[model samples]
Target: MIREPTKKKETSVTGCIRCGTCCKKGGPAFHLEDKPLIESGTILAKHLFTIRKGEPAYDNLKGCLLPSATDIIKIKSQKSARTCIFYDEESSRCKIYHKRPVECKALKCWDTREIEAIYDRNRLTRQDLMGDINGLWDLIEDHQERCAYETVLTLVDEIKASKTDPLLEKKALYIIQYDLQIRSSVIKKGNVDSHMIDFLFGRTIFDTLKSLGMNIRRKNGKHLFTTTIPSDPQPT
Candidate 1:
């Protein structure tokens, strides 16, 4: 029987083999904001399996602290080996198609050159942001490899602390905490409260002087200020 190709929605990329290859642990990761879809009632989360720290990870080399069975997609090609935890196989489509992460929603293939190019560029910014966040910390590990994303997110806060813009700072801090929540790293250390991160990052208004490009040279690290640090907004 000959099958007809259906025209897909015109977005960034197209064509997924439905193989769970990309969704497995260590393949690509999800951040805090992305978890809402899964936690908010996605079918895939219930069936998706995870292998923990010492256990053998999925085809992508990621272990689950609590791995369970999720939906599966039969793989037709070696390149897309392993079933997708989100596929409905019987229907030949994604189970969480509408709520899939940015990466899954943005896949590309040989026929979609322009779409691939667009996806590549967009993916780079996100990947680079993760890399940037990783560089900011020294205690990061590759576990589920999700920790580094939050660590680097701290950098967004480093800048936020110095800005006089409360909204701007809150937005940046929100991004960092929001991401940590998605990665499930929010509870890793020191309570992982978004409010706490916000408090710490928020209270750091000292950055404004730091960003002025006017180096406040300390005499042996002592503040030259005869007064105390400003509590209210200074930069208008």
Candidate 2:
């Protein structure tokens, strides 16, 4: 039978040797750019941060976070027995191929130009973080608004989590921030935290933020009037 030529399979990024030089060896500090897919403006890449240091991105003791992605699978480099977290031994490519940070994406065996681009991009990340903080909050608020009152309630629970889980810390921060914003506008009369959160998540943010202080001053003597409707979760 006449022989037919077989086409070569497309190689993914996994084709590289297991040299930790790509990631283990530190380059300029870099951060993941969370740019909006639509915006085309010049982005000053800011560092979100390195996951870990004194070792490769994924892990130090264990080897690369994704060593399986490398062409040369195990950490044969005894000098630095670390492999990449994104390395896939099976396929030999970065797991984060699509979303790898600019530095990782710009890496090349011999291309100095690609290498330079990574450092150039690293210089611009600090400025990137400022807008993201507010933007993420806006996004969270949007989710709460669109999801009805359910999402904000989750925030309340999240705040109550604890020291063991990091979620509670974030939840508390979110609550405080929301309370602050609500208070920034509304000239509230009494207790601000609980009630303001209640209203902000339930009604117009503008109105909630702009509400006049409610039930202010002592009527006869003792208790100061604060507008806090306590949460209704009974002790379990």
Candidate 3:
């Protein structure tokens, strides 16, 4: 007896398969076109974070970490994981599928041209969203100035060149402390949401330094650098 021929599985090369690979990598950065979503409260501020200008971040197109030219507001990933906060792992779907941001909409794992074309264009920034808010914008501006990565990186270079210079080390420590202090002040006094701290001031300086291979720890009430700085440090 002849057996029935085996049926081939169906597959498509176009469109998303809901594989969740992109979401698991991390959320997409917000573009200017996505501003309406935030303004309309469809995407709340607490669900997002910022990679401040000059901060080192991974460039999807370039395929390497580099200093960002402008603010890159992105959906926050789940705590202790790179998975996007909006992704529903149980269902393998996006919670805000319909109201997803431009990046999410443009992304097609099968065809990346659309996402790459607009990935780095028209990025939405804190100024665009909150520039009109009195007092708040001023605070954000001040924070950016005080904790600028350019300044911090320069200090790191100086500390590295003069390994035994206490002054250079102290300056770097002070900046880190100030970064931490301002976040606390905003949360307690300004009544800012704790979750917004990362967006407001980027990641903590301690985390940034650690990423650069410098380990910071407190001993006897003094912050000390425990690891030798990398000879050729990348921005991150």
Model 2 bad stretches (over 4 Å) = 1-82, 122-127, 130-236
lDDT of 2 by residue, 1-236 (tens): 00011122244544456454564433223333534311332322121121111111232223333211111101111134334444555665555566554655555544435544443233332224333666444643453444333343354444333213445434433444554455444435434344323222333322221222122232463223234423343210
Q: In lDDT terms, which candidate is top?
A: 3
Candidate 2 structure lDDT:
0.34
Question: What does candidate 3's lDDT look like per residue over 197-231, in tens digits?
Answer: 87777788878877775658878966788756666
- Give the lowest summed-lDDT range of ten residues in model 1: 66-75
Between candidates 2 and 3, name the one with more favorable TM-score. Answer: 3
Superior by lDDT: candidate 2 or candidate 3: 3
Ranking by lDDT: 3, 2, 1
Candidate 3 weakest lDDT stretch, 10 residues: 1-10
